[model samples]
Target: MESGNSIHQKPVFWQESMPELRPCHNRTVTAQRTYGGISAAERRAGRRAALLDAALEIIGTQGVDKLTVAGLCAQAGLNERYYYEQFTGRDAVLTALFDGIAEELASAIVQALQEVAGGSAADTPSAARENAANPSARRMRPETRTMAHAAVAAGIHVLTDDPRKAQVALAVSASTPELRSRTLQTIASFANLVAARGIDFYALSTPTPDPAIGFRATYLVGGLVQTLTSWLQGDIDMTREQLIDETTDVFVLLGEDLAQRLR
Candidate 1:
């Protein structure tokens, strides 16, 4: 292994024979080559991210229709040429932005559910025993409430923490045909994820073979999306805490009813 001092020392080939004669020229060359150095791919990806962020701001503040290439490039502080290098057009940027938010929301909800379930398994032994003794008591367990609260809070935070993400994911996507189609596909993907989680949570038989389970997942996803969209759009008037509490209650009640019906 090389010593730290040796590791940082200039290579033998990098040393100049007549150091005093070309010091300024060598320094200028090195500075030009390494200053703000980044790989081409990294630069491209960075530009793309900046453009996406600018798109979100424009879509969130103005409407989606107002998102022009010139405006987006200006907001991103990148040239129009750089915009074309990443996205084909404004619609592509919109699609990418919507997909990114949808992905984040789904991941947040899944992580929240996993954490809650793990905690419940660790800390709810007494409640679990009581639930085992009384089937009706399962839905009333402290663990159940904890899981509901965590899931709702996670989902809502993905929206509320960034208004731009909320507007792009919920509002802007619905305004155009292409974006709407992409949003619907994203919703179906999330619904499948929820359905899979439900099967595991309920310890249901594999090869589910039941259409109702799928339908129930779709219903839950659609209802939650509509509720969130309404809340973000100001159609629903409630504080963040109120929304979280009410949504958590609704989810817990829905889960209980669904669990009963599934049996």
Candidate 2:
């Protein structure tokens, strides 16, 4: 038994002197060799991204209810066959669309936080003192704060930047749980950012912080969703900036009311 194990150990020890062959890289290379390549899957994912982009553009132009694969294909510059290759139907595409939108919003939020946290050096003692007292203080620097706001604004623009996408986010909030959750999440995060900057918007502090704050966030977010949808439905006559400004006001009030309720 010892001799048999020693035989295997000799080759294993000798292998340490040569280049290591990781299974993942080895398997990938071997698969490519056996199947003739990486270009296929890479190209496949690219087409899918393009298809989704086209779908978003279509939905932005034509509302969710009217979004069809053929319609998306026409907007995407791909044909029916390509659409079929990537998605089964309008349901599948919408599911993919929600997933994509969620990713974009999440990325914007995370990137804003990361960028703010990574802002440059401060020379003054006051700046250093602020950092020691509250680590995230640097994130509120003029440029950094502007970028953070821009990220949220960009996310808001994602839905509102295009008429069709805005229509979908608002319209489907009630009908689709995923869209509702995503929209609310973005609104809550944006509210938090604005609050941090001392800007007026939803719940600053509260005794029943968990539930009350949550309710406030939902109210503010849901209101925006409803407002945007209504506007798309021609129930409201406000411009995009007007809607965003009103939303900020609603959040500020919600934030203060939440604190009072908590107290």
Candidate 3:
């Protein structure tokens, strides 16, 4: 047997200037390689999207209880490792899916509002003329009515056009205790968005920080979500357009009333 000191000796190859013995950059290159024109990051993103889609299918159909890591991986057509790569666990997947749907709805509504606002500047005179002719019909300012309709229609389409998204956002999100808490927090965030938009549109004397403004905003957004969930569940029977119209009316009425009270 070799002595302990002999075992510590460097091998002859260590004396040679062996570039191959140095830390290899092959891993870095391989990691970034666009295999079949898709980089590793792109592949990861694709897997993440697939997982989210799978979560939507599972949660929307089987309920959140059925959304296990194994079930998610199976639905995504991905390995368990891929699921772990994108999400810490089942709750993370649900949260991400819900948040994505919420963001999509919020973006659609904001865009619709912005489009109406932009056109209002050009169309104000005609709208004003119409309001003058039907003064009794103009409880809600023409611009406010237009904005309300645009925002409501956009939000309804986003939720209903893809029923799965609504199911995930409304039903499944409230299925589990953890998810219910998350949903409440999301309601608060959406309420803040509503308050900010109301401030900009109604030019309310009460600032967004005012409790009354906060209360109305929360009431509007939270009530809308509850009503939408009921409608989606058949508890409320109405056509898509009718739903949009009725929701728009509530938004305008309560909004104007709250603005007046604040003033």
TM-score winner among the candidates?
Answer: 3
* Model 3 per-residue lDDT tens digits across residues 1-263: 00000111221211211122333655422224579989666677777878888888887788778889889889989999887666766666767777777767677888988877777532666456545554432776777767777788898898798787887776645567987887887778878777888877777644234687788888988888889888988999898877877777788887888787766
TM-score of each: 0.76, 0.55, 0.79
How does candidate 3 fare on TM-score? 0.79
Q: Please identify model 3 stretches exceeding 4 Å from their true place.
A: 1-31, 121-138, 205-209
Best by lDDT: 3
What lDDT would candidate 1 get against the real structure? 0.68
For each predicted model, how many residue pairs clash, with residues at least 3 apart or on different chains?
A: 0, 10, 0
Error of 3 at 188 (Å): 0.8
> lDDT of all the models against the reference?
0.68, 0.52, 0.72
Comparing 1 with 3 on lDDT, the higher-scoring candidate is 3
Error of 1 at 13 (Å): 43
Clashes of 2: 10
State in Å the error of residue 4, model 1.
47
Q: Across residues 1-263, which tens digit of lDDT does each residue of candidate 2 receive?
A: 00001111221111111223347744732333213465555655666777777766666666676677667777767767877766656655665565455455555655654554465424344346544554344444433323334444555676665555554455445546654665455456544443443322223443333654555555665566667667667788877655554554454445555555554
